[model samples]
Target chain A: MSDVKKFMYVNRKAPYGTIYALESLEVVLISAAFDQDVSLAFVDDGVYQIMKGTKTDGIGMKNFSPVYNALGDYDITKLYVEQESLDERGLTLDDLMDIKYEDEDDDWAEKPSIKVVSRKEMADVMDQQDVLMSF
Target chain B: MKLSVLVNEGPYQHQASDSALLFTKAALEKGHEIFRVFFYHDGVNNGTRFTVPPQDDRNLQESWTALQAEHELDLVVCIAAAQRRGILDENEAERQGKDGNNIAPGFRISGLGQLVEAGIESDRLVVFGD
Candidate 1:
């Protein structure tokens, strides 16, 4: 196998309604397990995945926001939110879990070195990756 | 670098397609080559030729068609998903004995091999799915 060192995972779906969120999370965990440098970004409705205190029991689904916290155990700690997405949804940093907030900055301001970026910056970040997988 | 982009959401249904388009445009602008763009699940709707969004609104299908024409982008719709959703090309419509094909030009009917090929050949395979 080639020594692929970096990976970026972009999540673009809501949490409960479909399999995209869950499967994307699984893929991130698996990529991190292989010791690849993994980072995740949430765009559009995907921002819901990291919202604080999500309760899914009323909808007959298991609460899964806790998985966000568990991501730290796998060393896949670079979690990003598109600034435009947050602004469009009227969400602030306090409304989210413990994740680095970045807006077009390639360098992040949190643990695990995951940078949050804007839609415009995605191409540059993507270009720097050895492996990029979106879910 | 080789690249594969997975588009899972339908055009105009959400921002996923827009973001995917922007990403593809940016990737190309930066001199990166896209190996393939795979449409899975509801994304196959992107290949529909019958789409006619209200004249007042933006026509995403036209935008995608323009992109394909401009770059000769490899647009592939998953056969399984397209079949389930009734989006068929001429070959597929004939093979399945359907009356007609509704898929748009510049879009081809293909399988997971295109996706696998992207994963294997590209330096990175990014997905834009919902």
Candidate 2:
């Protein structure tokens, strides 16, 4: 059916500086409610959004980094983090927040949602999406 | 082919609206059907009827209105974003007790579901933003 479209959300900006990150999350949440096949890619500065120790208290903003932890509740578990972006920023996978979900089909085994991919590999994922929304 | 276009930025301040317009016009010229054009975030500002740009420059709102007139394009402004940005329709203005409504012709305020529906109904969903 044309209604079950594969949606890919591309996030290329850092969070907090602008509203793109928050607005994008809102769209993703809305897309999830539609039960569409959705995937998210964090490229460039977008990777910074998921990094650990993201304190927004000084900015008088809520710490939104923890929201990534709740994405699995919406069945949104495909989060691709570009490896090149992390390397350029001198960040390692450990620097990111651990986002995992329990797979009920697999005896409730915990599974990590974030996938580290190369720039080229991320391009392949983008190609497979029927609808791509950027933020 | 049925296409869905999403504009994520305001007009003039960014190249998004201009590019979206060009792309929509080209797609229409090529005989492609537009399922809908969703305006989200700051993009909702593009649906205001009260913009008064200089006479020398082309008015983006008028351009969009003319295109919608010619093509019957479905222009949907996200209600949440429109309300936040003060781009209210008559119903919304009355509900909010505002002085007036400023929603441009050919644009209707709706929910975020319209954006998702466009992706499902359209063959391609193109996003224009900064």
Candidate 3:
């Protein structure tokens, strides 16, 4: 019931090997703290951000992917995955974590009460939000 | 309307900076006011004056400098991030006993408050990152 606006975070980089994912996550958390309606879309290498079972200890980096699961507690549950990106990377819904999915065919269908989706569908959803931030 | 832009990736490392520049220009062209640009993490490198790209390249640092000059944009680099990366202004370089300053003009070293203020002041906050 908060009057806060809506925001869409477009993530396009891999979770690790760079600071983009970490910084983007921080921004999302901060935006959520303001009571904004927050959503996230993963495209390109960014899909790796929500992949299951990651271990970064060998690289002296902590595995932060687990923190993503806690986003729902902040009311940031809208997570999407680009269909083409998944197909190109040979990934399936099973390869990702538990979230909603938005396929191209479901554009006009009721948003599945879930969190996965395709890039084209994500663009449409982004247009509905007050702000679209890409990372 | 006022817009706050967040640039989180270094210039040329990805298309983030270019995209941000384009967005800023487009927003201005539409008669919008830019509240501020908060450069964080690796994005602080965009303000480094010592960077020189190859002769055949488009000098991104110079491009940013030009944008700042032309638009009088508020370019803010995070103090913590810049210090960790060895980018310092005249006062910071002198305080840290560095040989000279590496950060260019028109960019100020600031804290996270600038980002918060920008968010509060702008009607829209657009982030361009890696």
Candidate 4:
């Protein structure tokens, strides 16, 4: 419980093509177990990680996109997708998977977990974090 | 101030490990305490004693080993990443059914928790990677 810092994981690479996305997710999952204030920011090609309809059957790889859905269950739900990256890829928030979590503070109200933010807003979040782990 | 260094790339293939080493050296010269250098992803390759670079070139692994010897640095290679990339320590090699270990001097294979600990304990966690 000591030395709990605001940890931010930056993901700027796409999934499946390389191992960065999966490895980043693994670390994020591990960080979640620590009860740290963890946030995951997806920019550049990384925004594709949360995109809906991620079909990996053609490539014969595990569809790790589902892991994003489980982030809420693990209490690691602050998922940020940069607006610039998503717009550059011709994607809107509707193209992303429906991720949500139940808030006990609000009598178990379910709220959307992913946040679509501007690059500036993402930068501000980065500045606020005590640690930044990029992948 | 205490500093933690994170290297996410391997040896000569990328500048990450090299940059991390140089940064660590400079930080030490400035009288800063290095809490730990946690190697993750492909960076675990730097811990292998099997790396034999050309005599003419700077041996990256040797540089790190020398740093560890000179300053008693905490160089930790993530066990999960190491196992995934075949950089096994003596005990890990035996447990994983390998013939022998190739972990370099001064570098120890540990779990990813060390990284989290370093991130928390150190004033700054500088990551050098691709």
Candidate 5:
């Protein structure tokens, strides 16, 4: 486990228009079993993937938004959201789903996983990663 | 340095597969060790042996197969993605009750864990995609 590499899944596409988001999520789920230091970054249209109240009934596609809530259980608590992308898209943190994780180091206290950061901070996050897979 | 390559786009429709192949070739030429080449998403299409591009145009699958044959490269096609895209090996074809398999030579169907392992073991995990 000491060899855990920093794996970042960069999401820059919309949820359903293309298969990128779904496929990227699939990889993330599979990666959870590896016990690596994994993180998910939401930028551009990818921000919509975690948006609150995403209903797919009319679109005839499976709504995978709820899966974000389960990521914390998979030991993937780092969900970095780009503020610039949300701002450009006229969205705010309130528009996103509330994803929280239980902090075992803090007496199992529940903590929010989504972290809104400026573009500069997002760049730093990308720079600190050992592996970057953009979808 | 040890490196791993991830190709997320299909052949012909996008330049990702070609870029990854060229990059891997160049890296090997420079004396770098390629740990593995993982094909995911539409990239699994690159492992299909049914592709027959125009005679004048370069056949990407054949190119990858030839390079793999020469270098003994570990070419992996993601099983989930391959199933979705219909790129199956002989074993998978039988397991899935399919009548045929079209996976190109030197390519093996595997899970996404192979990609995660590649990332963890390789010095650099270069992803070529949109």
Candidate 6:
């Protein structure tokens, strides 16, 4: 009913081990329909949610990793990854899936959505959000 | 302040449900408006009418039901997550052709959009999860 509110979905748990990661994505996808200013913050083991080559065949779980690719189409693009979390996990930006969004304002130019930020920067992002949904 | 709460864990297995209930009660006592309380993931279990805890232990479902009645709260369980975990309401039971539905009083099965709407409408959205 009101103007758009800044929503940040803070993810901290590992994917698959718990249902948090997938369920958080479900809420993220649904939030797109509300025309809110939404962004995602991946810290701790949550960084694993976007890792490339996620194989769940032996585990017999639905590999929902591919669903992250469809996020760009939902008009939800900002994904802030904490640099410290990646370093502690021995992961690099290259380890993540290449999620891109087509910028409508720039003649539909493709741009990478995942922005690697320092812990301090991530804190600032969280500080500015009107609503924070943690998982 | 207007607030919305999201619960992401089951009743007895985790403390999230209890914490959320206490937090909601505290907020209500302080004269704050609770826009909605959205249940997701294993949190949908809190809406089951058949949960029978020990006599000494708190009946979380009934507690939540009573709270909702007192405050006129909007207690919503995510429909997709509920269906996956077998938490069907009357309409859902008939739609899915299930034999029974176990949704407790004062809680309704709805869409994930309700969660988003809660986030947008509330002054603060407090999440109770792992």
Rank candidates by DockQ, best first: 6, 5, 2, 4, 3, 1
DockQ of 5: 0.71
Fnat scores for every prediction: 0.29, 0.67, 0.38, 0.54, 0.71, 0.92
Superposed by TM-score, candidate 1 places the C-alpha of residue B100 at a distance from the truth, in angstroms, of 1.3
Instruction: lDDT for model 5, please.
Output: 0.94
Over 4 Å off in model 1, which ranges?
A: A1-135
lDDT of 4 by residue, B42-124 (tens): 99999998988988988998999999999999999999999988998889888889998899999999988889888888899
Error of 5 at B109 (Å): 0.2
* Worst 10-residue lDDT window, candidate 4 chain B: B111-120
How good is model 2 by TM-score?
0.94
The all-Cα superposition gives candidate 6 an RMSD in Å to the true structure of: 1.0
* Per-residue accuracy of model 2 over A1-135 as CA lDDT, tens digit each: 435778888999999999889888888888888989988999999998898888777899877787789888888999999999999999999999999977888998989999999999999999998888886
Residues B52-86, candidate 1, lDDT per residue (tens digit)? Answer: 88989877777778888999999998787789789
Answer with 1 or 5, whichever has the higher TM-score.
Answer: 5
> What is candidate 2's lDDT per residue for B81-130, written digit by digit as tens?
88888999999999999999999999999999899889888888899888
**Any runs in candidate 6 off by more than 4 Å, and if so which?**
none
Candidate 2 interface RMSD (Å)? 1.4
RMSD values, in order shown: 9.3, 1.6, 6.7, 1.2, 1.1, 1.0
Global lDDT of model 4: 0.91
RMSD, model 4, all Cα superposed?
1.2
- Which candidate should be chosen as best, given DockQ against the real structure? 6
- Kindly report the interface RMSD of candidate 3, rounded to 1 decimal: 4.2
Candidate 4: chain B TM-score equals 0.98
